[model samples]
Target: MTVSLYVPLASPVHRAPAGLKLGLLAALAVALFVVDRPEVVGAALVVVVAVGLLVARLPARSLWAQVRPVWPWLVLLLLFHGVFTDWRTGAVTTLRLLALVVAAAVVTSSTRVTELVAVVEWLARPLAVFGVRPARVGLVIAMTLRFIPLIAERAHRIREAQAARGAARMRWGILVPLLIQVLRLATTLGEALDARGADAPVTPPRRRAGASTS
Candidate 1:
Protein backbone atom coordinates (compact mmCIF):
# COMPACT_ATOMS: atom_id res chain seq x y z
CA MET A 1 0.00 0.00 0.00
CA THR A 2 1.25 3.48 -0.86
CA VAL A 3 1.23 5.91 2.02
CA SER A 4 0.87 9.64 1.47
CA LEU A 5 2.94 12.11 3.46
CA TYR A 6 -0.13 14.15 4.35
CA VAL A 7 -2.16 13.16 7.37
CA PRO A 8 -5.83 14.11 7.22
CA LEU A 9 -6.80 16.34 10.13
CA ALA A 10 -9.43 18.92 10.98
CA SER A 11 -6.97 21.16 12.81
CA PRO A 12 -6.39 24.81 11.98
CA VAL A 13 -2.96 24.02 10.54
CA HIS A 14 -4.56 21.69 8.07
CA ARG A 15 -7.04 24.40 7.18
CA ALA A 16 -4.31 27.00 6.70
CA PRO A 17 -3.33 28.01 3.16
CA ALA A 18 -0.61 25.95 1.51
CA GLY A 19 1.24 29.06 0.32
CA LEU A 20 1.40 30.40 3.84
CA LYS A 21 2.87 27.19 5.20
CA LEU A 22 5.43 27.13 2.42
CA GLY A 23 6.38 30.76 3.02
CA LEU A 24 6.80 30.18 6.73
CA LEU A 25 8.90 27.10 6.05
CA ALA A 26 11.16 29.12 3.75
CA ALA A 27 11.51 31.85 6.36
CA LEU A 28 12.32 29.31 9.06
CA ALA A 29 15.01 27.78 6.89
CA VAL A 30 16.64 31.16 6.35
CA ALA A 31 16.38 32.12 9.99
CA LEU A 32 17.89 28.83 11.15
CA PHE A 33 20.92 29.35 8.94
CA VAL A 34 21.39 33.04 9.79
CA VAL A 35 21.36 32.54 13.56
CA ASP A 36 24.38 30.55 14.67
CA ARG A 37 23.42 30.22 18.33
CA PRO A 38 22.79 26.66 19.43
CA GLU A 39 20.32 27.65 22.11
CA VAL A 40 18.26 29.70 19.66
CA VAL A 41 18.28 26.88 17.11
CA GLY A 42 17.33 24.45 19.85
CA ALA A 43 14.48 26.72 20.81
CA ALA A 44 13.33 26.87 17.20
CA LEU A 45 13.43 23.10 17.08
CA VAL A 46 11.29 22.91 20.21
CA VAL A 47 8.83 25.39 18.71
CA VAL A 48 8.58 23.32 15.53
CA VAL A 49 7.88 20.19 17.56
CA ALA A 50 5.20 22.00 19.53
CA VAL A 51 3.58 23.32 16.40
CA GLY A 52 3.55 19.90 14.80
CA LEU A 53 2.15 18.17 17.86
CA LEU A 54 0.03 20.90 19.45
CA VAL A 55 -0.93 23.27 16.65
CA ALA A 56 -1.00 20.91 13.67
CA ARG A 57 -2.20 18.02 15.83
CA LEU A 58 -0.17 15.62 13.81
CA PRO A 59 0.64 12.20 15.23
CA ALA A 60 4.16 11.83 16.64
CA ARG A 61 4.88 8.93 14.30
CA SER A 62 3.99 11.02 11.27
CA LEU A 63 6.67 13.58 12.10
CA TRP A 64 9.09 10.87 13.17
CA ALA A 65 8.75 9.04 9.87
CA GLN A 66 9.90 12.12 8.00
CA VAL A 67 12.83 12.71 10.37
CA ARG A 68 13.99 9.14 11.00
CA PRO A 69 15.79 8.88 7.68
CA VAL A 70 18.07 11.83 8.45
CA TRP A 71 19.34 10.76 11.87
CA PRO A 72 22.39 9.04 10.43
CA TRP A 73 23.33 12.08 8.38
CA LEU A 74 22.88 14.33 11.40
CA VAL A 75 25.10 12.15 13.50
CA LEU A 76 27.79 12.18 10.85
CA LEU A 77 27.54 15.95 10.56
CA LEU A 78 27.92 16.34 14.31
CA LEU A 79 30.92 14.05 14.37
CA PHE A 80 32.54 15.85 11.43
CA HIS A 81 32.19 19.20 13.11
CA GLY A 82 33.39 17.86 16.44
CA VAL A 83 36.51 16.43 14.81
CA PHE A 84 37.39 19.36 12.52
CA THR A 85 35.68 22.43 13.92
CA ASP A 86 34.38 23.18 17.41
CA TRP A 87 31.62 21.06 18.89
CA ARG A 88 29.48 24.17 19.25
CA THR A 89 29.37 24.76 15.50
CA GLY A 90 28.56 21.12 14.89
CA ALA A 91 25.80 21.11 17.51
CA VAL A 92 24.30 24.30 16.09
CA THR A 93 24.47 23.03 12.52
CA THR A 94 22.87 19.71 13.46
CA LEU A 95 20.11 21.49 15.33
CA ARG A 96 19.48 23.74 12.35
CA LEU A 97 19.06 20.72 10.07
CA LEU A 98 16.85 18.86 12.54
CA ALA A 99 14.67 21.94 13.01
CA LEU A 100 14.29 22.43 9.28
CA VAL A 101 13.41 18.79 8.72
CA VAL A 102 10.81 18.81 11.47
CA ALA A 103 9.33 22.08 10.26
CA ALA A 104 9.02 20.71 6.72
CA ALA A 105 7.43 17.53 8.07
CA VAL A 106 4.80 19.60 9.86
CA VAL A 107 4.05 21.54 6.69
CA THR A 108 3.82 18.48 4.45
CA SER A 109 1.80 16.52 6.95
CA SER A 110 -0.74 19.36 7.16
CA THR A 111 -0.94 20.24 3.47
CA ARG A 112 -2.37 18.21 0.61
CA VAL A 113 -0.42 17.38 -2.53
CA THR A 114 -2.93 19.12 -4.76
CA GLU A 115 -2.81 22.22 -2.59
CA LEU A 116 0.99 22.30 -2.84
CA VAL A 117 0.85 21.95 -6.62
CA ALA A 118 -1.68 24.77 -6.88
CA VAL A 119 0.59 27.03 -4.83
CA VAL A 120 3.53 26.14 -7.05
CA GLU A 121 1.58 26.94 -10.19
CA TRP A 122 0.45 30.27 -8.75
CA LEU A 123 4.01 31.17 -7.80
CA ALA A 124 5.28 30.21 -11.24
CA ARG A 125 2.64 32.24 -13.11
CA PRO A 126 4.90 35.27 -13.50
CA LEU A 127 7.41 33.10 -15.38
CA ALA A 128 4.90 32.81 -18.22
CA VAL A 129 6.53 35.85 -19.80
CA PHE A 130 9.73 33.81 -20.11
CA GLY A 131 7.94 31.03 -22.04
CA VAL A 132 7.46 28.92 -18.92
CA ARG A 133 4.17 27.13 -18.50
CA PRO A 134 3.02 27.32 -14.89
CA ALA A 135 0.97 24.19 -15.24
CA ARG A 136 3.97 22.27 -16.51
CA VAL A 137 6.09 23.53 -13.66
CA GLY A 138 3.44 22.44 -11.21
CA LEU A 139 3.18 19.05 -12.86
CA VAL A 140 6.94 18.58 -12.57
CA ILE A 141 6.92 19.42 -8.90
CA ALA A 142 3.94 17.14 -8.24
CA MET A 143 5.54 14.24 -10.09
CA THR A 144 8.82 14.74 -8.26
CA LEU A 145 7.05 14.55 -4.92
CA ARG A 146 5.10 11.47 -5.97
CA PHE A 147 8.18 9.77 -7.33
CA ILE A 148 10.08 9.98 -4.03
CA PRO A 149 7.85 7.48 -2.26
CA LEU A 150 7.48 5.37 -5.37
CA ILE A 151 11.23 5.03 -5.67
CA ALA A 152 11.56 4.12 -2.02
CA GLU A 153 8.87 1.48 -2.40
CA ARG A 154 10.62 0.00 -5.40
CA ALA A 155 13.93 -0.11 -3.54
CA HIS A 156 12.32 -1.89 -0.61
CA ARG A 157 10.81 -4.48 -2.92
CA ILE A 158 14.15 -4.99 -4.62
CA ARG A 159 15.85 -5.55 -1.27
CA GLU A 160 13.21 -8.06 -0.21
CA ALA A 161 13.56 -9.98 -3.43
CA GLN A 162 17.29 -10.07 -3.14
CA ALA A 163 17.10 -11.30 0.44
CA ALA A 164 14.69 -14.04 -0.56
CA ARG A 165 17.15 -15.15 -3.22
CA GLY A 166 19.75 -15.89 -0.50
CA ALA A 167 21.86 -12.87 -1.36
CA ALA A 168 23.88 -12.00 1.75
CA ARG A 169 25.25 -8.73 0.39
CA MET A 170 22.19 -7.23 -1.30
CA ARG A 171 23.34 -3.64 -1.36
CA TRP A 172 25.04 -3.81 -4.79
CA GLY A 173 22.74 -6.58 -5.94
CA ILE A 174 19.63 -4.46 -5.57
CA LEU A 175 21.01 -1.43 -7.35
CA VAL A 176 21.02 -2.84 -10.87
CA PRO A 177 17.42 -4.05 -10.80
CA LEU A 178 16.27 -0.87 -9.05
CA LEU A 179 17.98 1.32 -11.61
CA ILE A 180 16.50 -0.68 -14.50
CA GLN A 181 13.01 -0.43 -13.03
CA VAL A 182 13.38 3.30 -12.44
CA LEU A 183 14.54 3.81 -16.02
CA ARG A 184 11.58 1.84 -17.36
CA LEU A 185 9.18 3.79 -15.21
CA ALA A 186 10.68 7.09 -16.39
CA THR A 187 10.48 6.02 -20.04
CA THR A 188 6.82 5.01 -19.67
CA LEU A 189 5.96 8.30 -17.94
CA GLY A 190 7.79 10.28 -20.63
CA GLU A 191 5.86 8.51 -23.38
CA ALA A 192 2.57 9.11 -21.61
CA LEU A 193 3.37 12.80 -21.14
CA ASP A 194 4.35 13.11 -24.81
CA ALA A 195 1.08 11.50 -25.92
CA ARG A 196 -0.76 14.03 -23.72
CA GLY A 197 1.08 16.92 -25.41
CA ALA A 198 2.76 18.04 -22.18
CA ASP A 199 5.88 18.96 -24.15
CA ALA A 200 4.07 21.36 -26.49
CA PRO A 201 5.23 24.96 -26.33
CA VAL A 202 2.84 27.66 -25.12
CA THR A 203 2.27 30.71 -27.31
CA PRO A 204 2.87 34.08 -25.68
CA PRO A 205 -0.16 36.36 -25.51
CA ARG A 206 0.00 39.44 -27.70
CA ARG A 207 0.93 42.63 -25.84
CA ARG A 208 -1.27 45.75 -25.89
CA ALA A 209 -0.15 48.69 -28.04
CA GLY A 210 0.83 50.78 -25.00
CA ALA A 211 2.37 47.89 -23.08
CA SER A 212 5.94 48.49 -21.98
CA THR A 213 8.48 45.68 -22.51
CA SER A 214 10.07 46.47 -19.19
Candidate 2:
Protein backbone atom coordinates (compact mmCIF):
# COMPACT_ATOMS: atom_id res chain seq x y z
CA MET A 1 0.00 0.00 0.00
CA THR A 2 1.29 3.39 -1.00
CA VAL A 3 0.48 6.13 1.42
CA SER A 4 -0.33 9.47 -0.17
CA LEU A 5 0.62 11.06 3.15
CA TYR A 6 3.32 13.49 2.16
CA VAL A 7 3.95 15.92 -0.66
CA PRO A 8 7.43 17.02 -1.60
CA LEU A 9 6.87 20.67 -0.89
CA ALA A 10 8.88 23.51 0.58
CA SER A 11 6.92 23.87 3.75
CA PRO A 12 7.79 24.92 7.30
CA VAL A 13 8.29 21.32 8.39
CA HIS A 14 10.64 20.88 5.45
CA ARG A 15 12.45 24.07 6.37
CA ALA A 16 12.80 23.47 10.11
CA PRO A 17 16.09 22.29 11.52
CA ALA A 18 16.30 18.52 11.18
CA GLY A 19 17.52 18.09 14.73
CA LEU A 20 14.42 19.69 16.10
CA LYS A 21 12.11 17.56 14.02
CA LEU A 22 14.02 14.45 14.90
CA GLY A 23 13.80 15.26 18.56
CA LEU A 24 10.10 15.87 18.33
CA LEU A 25 9.56 12.61 16.53
CA ALA A 26 11.59 10.72 19.06
CA ALA A 27 9.80 12.30 21.95
CA LEU A 28 6.41 11.61 20.41
CA ALA A 29 7.23 7.97 19.86
CA VAL A 30 8.41 7.56 23.41
CA ALA A 31 5.37 9.33 24.76
CA LEU A 32 3.06 7.19 22.69
CA PHE A 33 4.77 4.06 23.85
CA VAL A 34 4.48 5.04 27.47
CA VAL A 35 0.81 6.00 27.30
CA ASP A 36 -0.55 2.94 25.49
CA ARG A 37 -4.03 4.36 25.33
CA PRO A 38 -6.19 4.35 22.24
CA GLU A 39 -7.54 7.80 23.00
CA VAL A 40 -4.01 9.10 23.39
CA VAL A 41 -2.88 7.40 20.22
CA GLY A 42 -5.86 8.76 18.39
CA ALA A 43 -5.05 12.23 19.58
CA ALA A 44 -1.45 11.83 18.50
CA LEU A 45 -2.55 10.58 15.10
CA VAL A 46 -4.75 13.62 14.73
CA VAL A 47 -1.84 15.84 15.56
CA VAL A 48 0.33 14.01 13.08
CA VAL A 49 -2.27 14.35 10.34
CA ALA A 50 -2.69 18.01 11.10
CA VAL A 51 1.06 18.55 11.02
CA GLY A 52 1.30 16.76 7.68
CA LEU A 53 -1.42 18.98 6.29
CA LEU A 54 -0.69 22.31 7.95
CA VAL A 55 3.03 22.23 8.70
CA ALA A 56 4.16 20.06 5.85
CA ARG A 57 1.71 21.73 3.49
CA LEU A 58 1.00 18.41 1.90
CA PRO A 59 -2.18 18.07 -0.06
CA ALA A 60 -4.61 15.32 0.88
CA ARG A 61 -4.02 13.58 -2.42
CA SER A 62 -0.27 13.61 -1.98
CA LEU A 63 -0.58 12.41 1.60
CA TRP A 64 -2.69 9.52 0.39
CA ALA A 65 0.03 8.48 -2.03
CA GLN A 66 2.58 8.40 0.75
CA VAL A 67 0.36 6.36 3.07
CA ARG A 68 -1.37 3.97 0.67
CA PRO A 69 1.63 1.64 0.48
CA VAL A 70 1.47 0.83 4.19
CA TRP A 71 -2.30 0.53 4.46
CA PRO A 72 -2.35 -3.13 3.60
CA TRP A 73 0.42 -3.89 6.07
CA LEU A 74 -1.43 -1.97 8.72
CA VAL A 75 -4.58 -3.94 7.95
CA LEU A 76 -2.74 -7.22 8.18
CA LEU A 77 -1.05 -6.21 11.40
CA LEU A 78 -4.35 -5.17 12.89
CA LEU A 79 -5.88 -8.52 11.99
CA PHE A 80 -2.97 -10.48 13.39
CA HIS A 81 -2.80 -8.46 16.57
CA GLY A 82 -6.54 -8.53 17.10
CA VAL A 83 -6.72 -12.26 16.64
CA PHE A 84 -3.76 -13.16 18.82
CA THR A 85 -4.38 -10.75 21.66
CA ASP A 86 -7.36 -9.36 23.46
CA TRP A 87 -9.39 -7.44 20.92
CA ARG A 88 -9.46 -4.15 22.78
CA THR A 89 -5.77 -4.07 23.74
CA GLY A 90 -4.61 -5.44 20.39
CA ALA A 91 -6.61 -2.87 18.46
CA VAL A 92 -5.19 -0.08 20.61
CA THR A 93 -1.62 -1.31 20.26
CA THR A 94 -1.98 -1.66 16.50
CA LEU A 95 -3.37 1.84 16.18
CA ARG A 96 -0.58 3.20 18.33
CA LEU A 97 2.05 1.51 16.20
CA LEU A 98 0.40 2.80 13.05
CA ALA A 99 0.37 6.33 14.43
CA LEU A 100 4.07 6.10 15.24
CA VAL A 101 4.87 4.80 11.78
CA VAL A 102 2.84 7.51 10.05
CA ALA A 103 4.41 10.20 12.18
CA ALA A 104 7.87 8.96 11.26
CA ALA A 105 6.97 8.96 7.56
CA VAL A 106 5.83 12.56 7.83
CA VAL A 107 9.19 13.60 9.18
CA THR A 108 11.12 11.62 6.56
CA SER A 109 9.04 13.00 3.71
CA SER A 110 9.64 16.55 4.85
CA THR A 111 13.28 16.30 5.90
CA ARG A 112 16.04 15.94 3.35
CA VAL A 113 18.75 13.32 3.84
CA THR A 114 21.42 16.00 4.22
CA GLU A 115 19.40 17.66 6.94
CA LEU A 116 19.01 14.35 8.72
CA VAL A 117 22.74 13.73 8.62
CA ALA A 118 23.38 17.13 10.08
CA VAL A 119 20.91 16.37 12.82
CA VAL A 120 22.55 13.05 13.55
CA GLU A 121 25.93 14.70 13.69
CA TRP A 122 24.71 17.28 16.12
CA LEU A 123 22.98 14.70 18.26
CA ALA A 124 25.97 12.41 18.29
CA ARG A 125 28.39 15.10 19.39
CA PRO A 126 27.97 14.29 23.05
CA LEU A 127 28.74 10.64 22.45
CA ALA A 128 32.21 11.64 21.30
CA VAL A 129 33.26 11.83 24.95
CA PHE A 130 32.54 8.11 25.11
CA GLY A 131 35.00 7.53 22.23
CA VAL A 132 32.31 7.70 19.61
CA ARG A 133 33.28 9.79 16.61
CA PRO A 134 30.32 12.01 15.85
CA ALA A 135 31.54 12.87 12.38
CA ARG A 136 31.99 9.22 11.48
CA VAL A 137 28.60 8.33 12.87
CA GLY A 138 27.12 11.18 10.87
CA LEU A 139 28.82 9.96 7.73
CA VAL A 140 27.43 6.44 8.23
CA ILE A 141 23.96 7.79 8.85
CA ALA A 142 24.22 10.03 5.80
CA MET A 143 25.35 7.17 3.62
CA THR A 144 22.51 4.96 4.82
CA LEU A 145 19.95 7.67 4.18
CA ARG A 146 21.37 8.37 0.73
CA PHE A 147 21.23 4.67 -0.15
CA ILE A 148 17.58 4.12 0.84
CA PRO A 149 16.16 5.92 -2.17
CA LEU A 150 18.77 4.43 -4.44
CA ILE A 151 17.90 0.94 -3.27
CA ALA A 152 14.21 1.63 -3.84
CA GLU A 153 14.93 2.86 -7.36
CA ARG A 154 17.13 -0.10 -8.09
CA ALA A 155 14.45 -2.48 -6.86
CA HIS A 156 11.91 -0.83 -9.10
CA ARG A 157 14.20 -1.15 -12.11
CA ILE A 158 14.92 -4.78 -11.31
CA ARG A 159 11.21 -5.49 -11.02
CA GLU A 160 10.58 -3.84 -14.36
CA ALA A 161 13.35 -5.79 -16.02
CA GLN A 162 12.10 -9.03 -14.58
CA ALA A 163 8.59 -8.27 -15.78
CA ALA A 164 9.83 -7.49 -19.29
CA ARG A 165 11.70 -10.80 -19.32
CA GLY A 166 8.48 -12.60 -18.29
CA ALA A 167 10.11 -13.68 -15.03
CA ALA A 168 7.94 -11.44 -12.91
CA ARG A 169 5.93 -14.40 -11.70
CA MET A 170 9.07 -15.88 -10.20
CA ARG A 171 9.74 -14.37 -6.76
CA TRP A 172 13.31 -15.63 -6.53
CA GLY A 173 14.36 -13.83 -9.72
CA ILE A 174 13.38 -10.46 -8.30
CA LEU A 175 14.24 -11.15 -4.66
CA VAL A 176 17.61 -12.69 -5.33
CA PRO A 177 18.72 -10.00 -7.74
CA LEU A 178 17.50 -7.27 -5.44
CA LEU A 179 19.43 -8.74 -2.54
CA ILE A 180 22.55 -9.13 -4.65
CA GLN A 181 22.29 -5.57 -5.88
CA VAL A 182 21.93 -4.26 -2.34
CA LEU A 183 24.96 -6.27 -1.24
CA ARG A 184 26.88 -4.91 -4.20
CA LEU A 185 25.91 -1.39 -3.20
CA ALA A 186 27.04 -2.03 0.36
CA THR A 187 30.38 -3.33 -0.87
CA THR A 188 30.82 -0.28 -3.06
CA LEU A 189 30.01 2.00 -0.17
CA GLY A 190 32.55 0.28 2.03
CA GLU A 191 35.18 0.51 -0.69
CA ALA A 192 34.45 4.22 -1.12
CA LEU A 193 34.88 4.84 2.59
CA ASP A 194 38.11 2.86 2.65
CA ALA A 195 39.43 4.88 -0.29
CA ARG A 196 38.69 8.02 1.68
CA GLY A 197 40.56 6.60 4.72
CA ALA A 198 37.46 6.62 6.86
CA ASP A 199 38.74 4.02 9.31
CA ALA A 200 42.36 5.26 9.57
CA PRO A 201 44.85 7.91 8.56
CA VAL A 202 45.85 7.99 4.90
CA THR A 203 49.44 7.95 3.60
CA PRO A 204 50.38 10.35 0.83
CA PRO A 205 51.37 8.91 -2.50
CA ARG A 206 55.10 8.17 -2.73
CA ARG A 207 55.15 8.70 -6.49
CA ARG A 208 52.65 10.80 -8.36
CA ALA A 209 51.43 9.72 -11.80
CA GLY A 210 52.89 11.61 -14.76
CA ALA A 211 50.82 14.63 -15.90
CA SER A 212 51.12 13.34 -19.52
CA THR A 213 49.36 10.08 -18.53
CA SER A 214 45.77 9.74 -19.68
In terms of TM-score, the best-performing candidate is 1
lDDT of 2: 0.76
Candidate 1 stretches with Cα past 4 Å from truth are 139-214
List the candidates' TM-scores in order.
0.67, 0.60
Model 1 CA lDDT for position 160: 86
lDDT of 1 by residue, 1-214 (tens): 3457999999999999999999999999999989999999999999999999999899999899999999999999999999999899999999999999999999999998889889979999999999889988988887887788889989998888888889858568888899988887887897698778887864454557984532
Clash pairs (backbone) in predicted model 1: none
After TM-score superposition, what is the CA distance of residue 57 in candidate 1 from its true location, in Å?
A: 1.2
Please estimate how well model 1 matches the true structure, expressed as its whole-model Cα lDDT.
0.91
Residue by residue across 1-214, what tens digits does model 2's lDDT show? 2232234688888888878888898998889889877887888888898898887876766667667788887778778778887666776776787777777878878876667667778778999889899889977766665677787888889989988988778766677888877877776777688888886866654565674422
lDDT of each: 0.91, 0.76
